[model samples]
Target: MSDKRVPSMTPPNKAYPREELEEMMQKWLAANVEAEKAGDWPTYLGPMYTEDAVYSWNIGPNEDFVAEGRSEICDIALGFQMHGFEEWEYPYHDIIIDEKRGTVIGFWKQLAPYRRKDGSRFEIAGIGGSWFEYAGNYQWHWQRDFFDFGNAKDCFFQLAGAGALEPVVKKKIHQQAKGALLPGHRKLREEPSRWEKARNAMAMVKIAMTGR
Candidate 1:
């Protein structure tokens, strides 16, 4: 749990007028509500990204998921990754839009489809959210998701041990263990982690400004 590895950081994106960003976000949010209700992510969310969008999220300490371009984003990130989660609901708790930076953050909950034997809803522990960089035309060019890997593991184990997991999900867990890496997943060292670059930039800026 003490691994020092950090996920890559997205570069600064082009900014838009605050009014434009707000209007776009409002429309996008309304569409998202309907999409969530329908549970058709690939169909609904795929078009929300630019053709050359990049989407990424950390799987754990040793692996990361990165999908480049909209096709990959839709097929791998949205399609394969979401295969067994058709019935799950991710209700947004809050949304923050940084119009100056052309970014949007949405905090949500990952709720399972089924209830526990004790009649309580099964949900992943810890917070879940997505950070997105907006493109000018109502599309996102970059996206990253954050969630607690440990909590996700514990929840999955509890459901699986109790035989409450969806059949597809159980199969997927086995496949992930034994099968070859999916299209977008890579070993942690495979890609150059962007945190180092960000750190170097910060140091250079500080040195220039303060003569340190």
Candidate 2:
């Protein structure tokens, strides 16, 4: 098999300089966030992945949507932008750096136009893994499977799951879920499949156990 870097969790004992690793990581997250803010997804992915990059979405639930390569991935990403989907980005939060395997994983939040509907937004959280190779410094050979966030409700549960307040601070979500006539908010995930609903529901249940 042709040797290529893959995302892994193998810890490093003594590896490359810390400064060098941080630079590549900053480049990875910065470019991603820049594209997200500017809606320039094509430019966002072009630098970090190869043409034949293997990627996917919703590794846990809602696994139907999938893509490969820069073009295919950007097509899905830009589709959301063209449709006015918005997100909350945290480029520097909870980042774990491993120089041995040359990978970085961090937490992210995205709130955007729903896939099945327009003008309505939902939220999700994901972890990005970037595997790199040395070109005098680290250059990403490929970044794949940039996914694993749950649905809008799931994101809320994620925050709550992380020791945040459990009370549904915003009444807008349940309003939207029930398809109520609310201004500035619309029903997006009104009727999700059994699995889709289960993931977020169970996640929220865990939040209640956290003593809110």
Candidate 3:
């Protein structure tokens, strides 16, 4: 299998002081939280990334989403997905810092405002973490995320089943599920049946846990 790991863009010997790195991370997190709250994608969040930064995530085995450079990372990677998800929240619950490597991993959760029949808000509760490579001067040169796609797909299906998803949002999800490529993304290897089976299993688990 080909390596799915993202290569570091910054030099290995170049390191920032632990205190400075912590402060920078705190500032970036605060700015991102504020920008997200105000729905200001081009503001604080965009500035935290370096000019040649890379943003990426894995969809499944051998399938990935990648955005290289600031323009693609900002406009397509971060911007396009926010549509129809105005009420969605991504709150980082934990952070692990590697001072020597100049990397930080942030664990976050994706939450939707739509409530289920059991009065619980629809949420894809799974492991979601972003590994950020610090570029100094309070910016990151690389950011890659890992998350459970099966759980995410199940949440979306539940939303669609309840007629809670907007038409445009539903269409976008359908297109992606059918292997349509987004801007700055590489061609995806089709595995619709595998994804569907995973989603089905996740949905059954969710139903069992929620009793809904």
**TM-score for every candidate vs. truth?**
0.80, 0.46, 0.81
- Compared with the true structure, what per-residue lDDT tens digits does model 1 show for residues 1-212? 22333334564756788888778777777776776788777787888899988888888877878888899988998888887787888888888888878988989899998788899988988989999898888888888998999999999988887778877777778878894576677776643459977988999999999999
What tens digits encode model 3's per-residue C-alpha lDDT throughout 1-212? 22334555454646668998899879978986887798766566788899998888877665677777888777877788667776788888999888888888899998898898889999886899898888888898889888889998899889989999977797787897796765555534544588898998999999999986
- Each model's lDDT comes to 0.81, 0.48, 0.80
List where candidate 3 sits over 4 angstroms from the true fold: 1-13, 188-212
Measured over all alpha carbons after superposition, the RMSD of each candidate to the real structure, in angstroms, is 10.1, 12.1, 6.4
Q: Give the TM-score of candidate 3.
A: 0.81
- Which residue pairs in candidate 2 have backbone atoms (N, alpha carbon, C) closer than 3 angstroms, thus clashing? 86-111, 87-111
Q: Name the TM-score of candidate 1.
A: 0.80
Query: In candidate 3, how many Å is residue 43 off?
Result: 1.9
Q: Which of 1 and 3 is the better model by TM-score?
A: 3
Model 3 lDDT, full chain set? 0.80
